[model samples]
Target: METIVPNWPAPARVRALSTTRDGGLSQGAFAGLNLGAHVGDEAALVEANRGLLQQAAGIPGRLNWLNQVHGIAVHPVSNEYDGAPEADAACAHEAGLACIVMTADCLPVLLCDRAGTLVAAAHAGWRGLQNGVLEASIKAMGCKPAEILAWLGPAIGPSAFEVGGEVRDAFLAEQAEAVAAFIPSANEGKWLADIYQLARLRLARAGVSAVYGGEHCTFSDRERFYSYRRDGQTGRMASLIWLAE
Candidate 1:
């Protein structure tokens, strides 16, 4: 039931935390609070672990889990929202409506307004970042971008996240400054990309500069995170945000 609370200056009524691979009933590769039901973990185990998370975290309402497809579909979730929608980002303005995204190595960006009236969570893999997931999420908030506070949750670090040239090219096309985020890796024709910086660049472009929590590396921190790149059949940690009652 271990969780990493976001280190940002969000309002007191905003509740959010990024889960770690610790203190759960999951065994083997999916060990320790594996909340993702779509990652080949045992359905019963995943369900039970999710229940443990709800009880331990005291989430006020049902978590709106999205069937993430690495796309930029931004879903607006309410307390009554049901079913796992095919979306990569979710936003909520209602109190107790938790907006959550599960990730192993992909970046989970949790966002809330400074006033705590709106909250959102986005799953940003390379494709999602390159496309416009963060931008879409912020736009869906229906607030001024400057009023949003964002936290970049644990994901694969640049040292561990190598990518093909196409990935680098895609980002550069979106923002020239993205060049600073990529460097030549040892592998020929490959580049190491800092997803955190790329995400920051995207946020900046969308007028969101108040960002935090870009330190943790899931790939390198095997003891606390489940990395799909480090472990193919792995569990998923969740980053969730909700407006407290």
Candidate 2:
């Protein structure tokens, strides 16, 4: 299966990869490498796709999946963990344990320290982003925000992510800097919100300056990515990070 390795300067020992919506057995709306199991894709098909991805990435252990409540909850991965936990972000201090986040259009952020000692994955879907998901992740990593490196995975680009007044207000009310990421759209009372820029802005506010890989447009890239906004019943992609043994 095709994958997008994060383009940040993270240490070589910290391996991270984001899977695209290509090369899988899923058919119809969930076509091509759909990794998310909760999106109505067949459980067997998603398991098979996960197998393919793990083998492709040479992941040594099970990937930690989150229920993704779109909140600021961050969990630490442990061997006792069974299935998906109710959290929006996960961090791994142990090597070979993959911290994963599944998304269609919502932002999947991967973060790691320069020393490759800690890694985290966050699912930021505007609400979570505004509610301090990234900041929570950085804090959970137990490292200074400035010492962490962040990479933005595929998401609905600004041109495609139209939002109502409530969405804009949710962010602007907390962060005045977020106003720069919104622009007036053709529809009255709606604005085109740049999820990437907004995420970068939040990271910046948290003192994370080493951000990269925000150019992907899930809405526009039909072949390589899945867009929930473009297809209401589409599948989801996975962005994962882990430290090497």
Candidate 3:
């Protein structure tokens, strides 16, 4: 199975990967490498895809899945949680444990400290990002924000992510700096939102200076990734990070 290694200056022991929509057995809308079982894909097929991902990553432990309510909830993951946790982000300091977040077009932000002791993955849709999801994830890591490194995973690019006035106002209401992330669209009362820029602004506000990896465009890249905006019923890809054993 192929995976995208985050292009950041993180430590050697801080292993991280983001999966695309390739190398899986799911058919139709949930084509190659659909790792999310909550997306209506067959249970067996989803399991098979996840198994393939685990083998590729060489992670000995189960991936910590979250319910992803698109809120600011962050949870600490360990082996004790046998099933999915109801949170938007997860952090792990354990060697074998992996913190993972699934997404299609929404932003998946992966975080790790310079020392490689803590790692986290956050599902940052517009709601979550505006509601302090990244901040919460960083806080959950229990490390100073300055020592943390972040990588922005695949999501809907600015050109394709047109939003209504209300969506733009929601972010502006929380942080005035968010206004820079939106560009006026041709449609009246609409704007083209740059999710990567918004994430960078949020991370910067939280004091994380070392951020990278925001070139991926899920909506346009049909061959490499699945996009919920491009296709209504689509599969989900995952962004994962963990400390190496």
Candidate 4:
């Protein structure tokens, strides 16, 4: 039932939380609080865990879970949903409607405007960040970027996430200053990429200056969070937000 609430100064009605892998019924590798239905955990276990999540968060409304593909697509949600939609991000304008995304090592970003009329959750993996997932989510919210606030949830840290030269090159191609986010690892052409820094840079470029919570390291903290790189067959955590009615 443990959850991490955003520390940013979002409006009072802007409710948001990021779940940890600490309080659910899945066993074995997908041990506790595993909310990802597509990650090979027994369907029933994940469903039950999700129910626990609803009660713990006091959502008071239906959850609109998504089929995150690590792409830039942003789906809009209301109180009703036909099924989990295929999108890396979800935006909500309706009160009591939540926008959520699942993640392990990849970054989970929760966003809302100062007025709190809109909210969004995005799954920002390396590819998706490079391609523009956060920007797309921000654009979908239809708010002035300056009025938007972002909270960075758990993710693989720079010290633990090493990447080949191409990955560094990919980000550099978009913004040369992105080179600052990469430091040459011990491996000849490999680099330790700082996902938090990269995300901050992107948010700043997108005109979002008020950002918070890039402090959690999922790979290192096996107890509180899940990590795909730390464990291949691991559970996933949920980062969700909604407008309180």
TM-score of each: 0.98, 0.98, 0.98, 0.98
lDDT tens per residue, model 4, 150-220: 99999999999999999999999999889999999998989999999999999999999999999989999
RMSD of 2: 0.9
Tell me the lDDT of model 4 at 141. 94
Segments of candidate 2 deviating more than 4 angstroms: none
User: Against the unseen true structure, what C-alpha lDDT does each candidate score?
Assistant: 0.92, 0.92, 0.93, 0.93
For all predictions, the C-alpha RMSD in Å is 0.8, 0.9, 0.8, 0.8
Residue 105, model 3, lDDT: 95
lDDT of 2 by residue, 125-217 (tens): 999999999999999999988889999999999999999999999998888999999999999999999999999989998999999999999
Residue lDDT tens for model 1, 139-214: 9999999998999999999999999999999999889999999999999999999999999999999999899999
Per-model clash counts, in order, read 0, 0, 0, 1
Off by over 4 Å in 1: none
Q: Report the C-alpha displacement of residue 180, candidate 1, in angstroms.
A: 0.2
